[model samples]
Target: MKPSTPTRLFLLWMLTAPGCGLLLGLDDFEDAGKSTDTVSDTDGRCHIDEDCPSGLHGQAVCDDGTCEYTCAPGFADCSDSPGCETAITEDPEHCGSCRSPCAAHCVDGVCNAPVDIATSASSASACALMEAGDVWCWGLLPNAEGGSRTVPLPERIELPLPALQVAVGGTVFTGPHGLRAHFCALLADGTVRCWGTNQLGQLGLGDTGPHEGAQIPNVNGIREIAAGTDNTCAINAQNQLYCWGPRSTGLIEGDTTPAAPTLIAESVDQVSVASFHACAVMVDRTLKCWGLDFYGSLGLGAGGPTHATTPTSVGHGSNFAEVSCGLTHTCARSSSGVSCWGNNANGQLGLGSRTNYNSPQSLNLFASQTLRAGASHTAAVIAGDVYLWGSNAFKQMGSNDAFDTLLPVRLSLPSVSRLALGERFSCALTAEGRVLCWGANDHAQLGDGTLVSRATAAPVRWR
Candidate 1:
């Protein structure tokens, strides 16, 4: 039977209704299927939070028809990959954050941990040899204003090559011009580089003009280096020693002109210099000294010549391991123990008396691993313990007493591996790579983030 017109229209509408697949035109059905496929494909792309994949070390979220990734802390997506591939905490090129580079190794997201320290005897500056062969310095350092200023925190000093050792010297000029300090570093390429004041050609750059940055000295093949008041000295791999700068200390014979590096001695194992005197330990384990013999600093016995232009033997007949020269005194470590001589006005000799000794006086201490002498103080490390004596004017001995100590006193501290002394301050490096300082902070040589002096040991601030 044929359907009515009105009934035909109603049947067409019902065929097109949702979930009703009754008879319909082929083109219309094909269009409806295409629309359904488009919706299904869009939903398959990302409809729920779980539909997105998390990137490596990152979190992903489906938002606004797109997937966004968020990197975790200490990680960054520095590449085209879908993961955070860079770990900034351990990366030297991106230490603590992206694009921040470290001159040396990175530690716990921090850069430039110190491995060795150098302090000046007449100036308030100190330098550290970083683990990565870079150098960092603080205290009274040269500023960009063509003068010197105090730096409470460490700042990396630019160098042409990686450093193996560092030394500082020069006296704080009492005049209006600020400090007259200088710095030198033994580069990894067996050359020596220096900077700062060159009033006396201390930088070894041939001229006395002030230098702003690192400059190569007329010296090379250096294994060890030491800086003194207006002078510098170094020992080569061939056991030869060379010195330059002002001839006040007689480091070089002839006129009083500032000289380039000149051979001073041979068969030298180690060398140390001070304001007016210098000393060296020969390969035979004997000690020798030269320069101004103020208060018998030369250790040539009483009534000797006031000064010896050439190296003179310090006869004690003991096998010396190390020797250090102070402003007016000297101390040495040997198989027998530690001994000191020269000026003792402040008991810097570590003896039980204030009387000066024209010869080496035994400290009666045993198994001393290291010893160091400052302007008017002395320090020694025995069995991993630090002992100090002499001047307390700036609390250099780590004591609150106003009087100087006449004997060595142990400091309450962790196991110390090394020590560095300034004009009126001291620092010790712990076996765990930490640094502690005490005494004067007039120019922030203590590096504790303050300008106030301390009578006890304090940890150095890394920031």
Candidate 2:
């Protein structure tokens, strides 16, 4: 979605956007009422998109200090009563507004993702996120809004559905490995009913067993679940971590194999684990990680032929605000700046050269706030512009050289609000709430429909 010219502004228009906001300066909002230092509720005038800033997307024409989200054709307010939606939903051009629409239901005036929602009948493939206080999912355990709304005994798909995905299309969570797929979880309830590839006891059926259908009768206590190349990690309500699968590094750290949800970390926030390693942030925002460190994917200062058997600190970086783990490397944001360490074979470290580092190295960015690490590549945006480097074999770096970079390489994308990096691909949620993706498309990871890869940035179609 291109930036529409702003039309109005209102000071009394109050809205809150979580973790994402675009503060349009004088030049960006480009409306007629941009004064030097006067912005009162009575100063009604439109100038640009940010004029009547609230959770609404697009530029609003401010009339009497109120901004009306472009109420054009196909753009209708899908906000349920009492549901505080940041943007509009049901727009053919922009569904669910602000990046992704609600996960599934408008129940209770909130968007719920694909999970074991109460309003649902069975497990599904995906569910929309709702601001309301309920949940929903898609697939075929029964049918919430499909064939029927009532199913005797509440039957669901078989367990152990493979290939689970969260934060999909519109923040909906996807479960059920291959078959119709049965799963559970939503605001009211969340149980670990997973499917697919149960080798090495990942299904947590009390054995290194595999189930084609939902495993474990209920998984309500699960608070966080992360899927990796092969292994999976889940943190239960008690702040414990659990893992199952091949190539185990004892991440669960207990006498019993974490074939079930195990406890790990310092009871703070559990960071997402990647293919070979896992890390998390503590109550005070400190970082603790474990698992394989093949090429320094551990992010610990001293990198070598050593790996942590349990969660440990990284290179004296206690204040590590945020961290992202990739296939063989890790990048994190610290008080000072962004730093990376580990395998440089594909330049995933983003240290400027294809040289591997056994220690954390800082990048020479003008001013950086965050970083995201991919399989063997890394992407970061300092200020508002984006930069990527490392592992261009699949052209995930958005450069023509196909050579690994030791420094931060720039990707000329406009301002972005949120960023999510996949195994070998990267995605950015723009300030306009539209998703723009570039880089590798091997598995349609770029979501641009084609097996070809991109050497530069491009807009991905969500339609």
Candidate 3:
């Protein structure tokens, strides 16, 4: 029953008076339409989802009057913070996603990948072409001052277009005149770009100014390129060979200056240039060589001729697959096996002896997929294994023992797809696209972020 207004007022006043024991109940206020449930008040933390701040990993949201977060792909909120904080793109411990570990390197959400690698035979520098069409280099790199300097870690090289192949060439002399180095990159458009020391017009820019991104003039449709101590060569899609630079050892004939490309030979499949000589494998699988034959490097038989001004046939067969020219030696792979000629002062021929061979001398090993001849060393990949010989004074053989060997010695490594050799160092490209290097690191040629030389293979540090 409802009480009179005066009686209700007296009851409320008695409950509110001092020393009153009864507590005020909401039952009397129900008729005023008041809510019984608790309502939340956000004390300026956030009013809407857009009011919350986003962190490195991306977006945030407001829910139940509180700010919550969401992570973008390749990121995660692995910590107790209110923002997404972890990046899984390059973290080996959590590559691509949380708890997805990688064996060696993590790059752009993938693991252990590189496409091609090139090392200078004269200086301690190297470059690698990544699968993403970017180029990274280390060791003695070219500086903007038209000179070169040593770098202990990998640095990205800017290019106007994607690169298909990269080649490094240089020459080291005694005394104050130290190193003359250069680099060339073949773009997807069949144009060539070069930079570095251009004292002899090796950069192919029509002038010797140590330029960068200098394109070879009047040349297009080139399929391959090779650089030597002070010269460069290219082979167009039509199998025509062209060469430029100082006219030495018959590399260039007549009054053609070193500043312009000149036609050298035709139907050439592959060509390799060195300090004073050059060699090529014709389309018919026949090997031809010209230039100064130091210690019979031309493979024209002992006591034959000291120099050949024109392309002359070498060996006795047409099964030649490829050839590599070194400082004073040459090595070639034919259908039979691997054969080497010329300088063997350090047993670079892998012939199990210190005696130099004027003609082709076959090694006991079988066919090789890739072969390289350095200043005084040689490296070959046979059945996925690396075989190295010649000078070990710099521990380029991937062994701690600094002793020269005349026979080929196997390196402790995984399946190798390709190999590149420097004067005192070596690098190999693994089947998994990972790059491993050893030997001289005086200029950080190994790309391991240190100047200390290594006797065994170590993974390159990208960062």
Please report, as a residue range, the 10-residue window in candidate 1 with the lowest summed lDDT. 30-39
Instruction: Tell me the RMSD of model 1 versus the true structure.
Output: 14.4
Q: Model 2 over residues 277-385: C-alpha lDDT tens digits? A: 7777665767777877776667665533366777877665566677766666777777777777777887677665677775678876545655666666777777767
TM-score ranking from best to worst? 3, 1, 2
Residue 355 accuracy (lDDT) in model 3: 88
lDDT of 3 at 299: 92
Candidate 1 Cα errors over 4 Å, as ranges? 1-111, 144-146, 173-178, 214-217
- Please, what are the lDDT tens digits per residue for candidate 3 over residues 1-463? 9985444543554455432221122111101111111112235344455444334445666666566666666665443333444566777766666566654567776765468888655657888887766678888877887777888888888888888888887765553436667888888899888877776677766666657778888888989988777778899999999887767435677654555788889999999888788899999999999888888889999756787877789966879898998878999998888899889989999988888888889888777998898889998999999998899998898778878889998988999998888878899999877789999888888999899997989888877
TM-score of each candidate structure, all chains considered together: 0.78, 0.59, 0.80
- What candidate 3 gets wrong by more than 4 Å, as runs, is 1-72, 76-86, 92-112, 175-177
RMSD of each: 14.4, 14.5, 13.9
Ten contiguous residues minimizing lDDT sum, candidate 3: 26-35
Candidate 3 lands at a TM-score of 0.80
Task: Give the higher-lDDT candidate: 2 or 3.
Answer: 3
What is the Å distance of residue 180 in model 1 from its true position? 1.3
Error of 2 at 405 (Å): 2.6
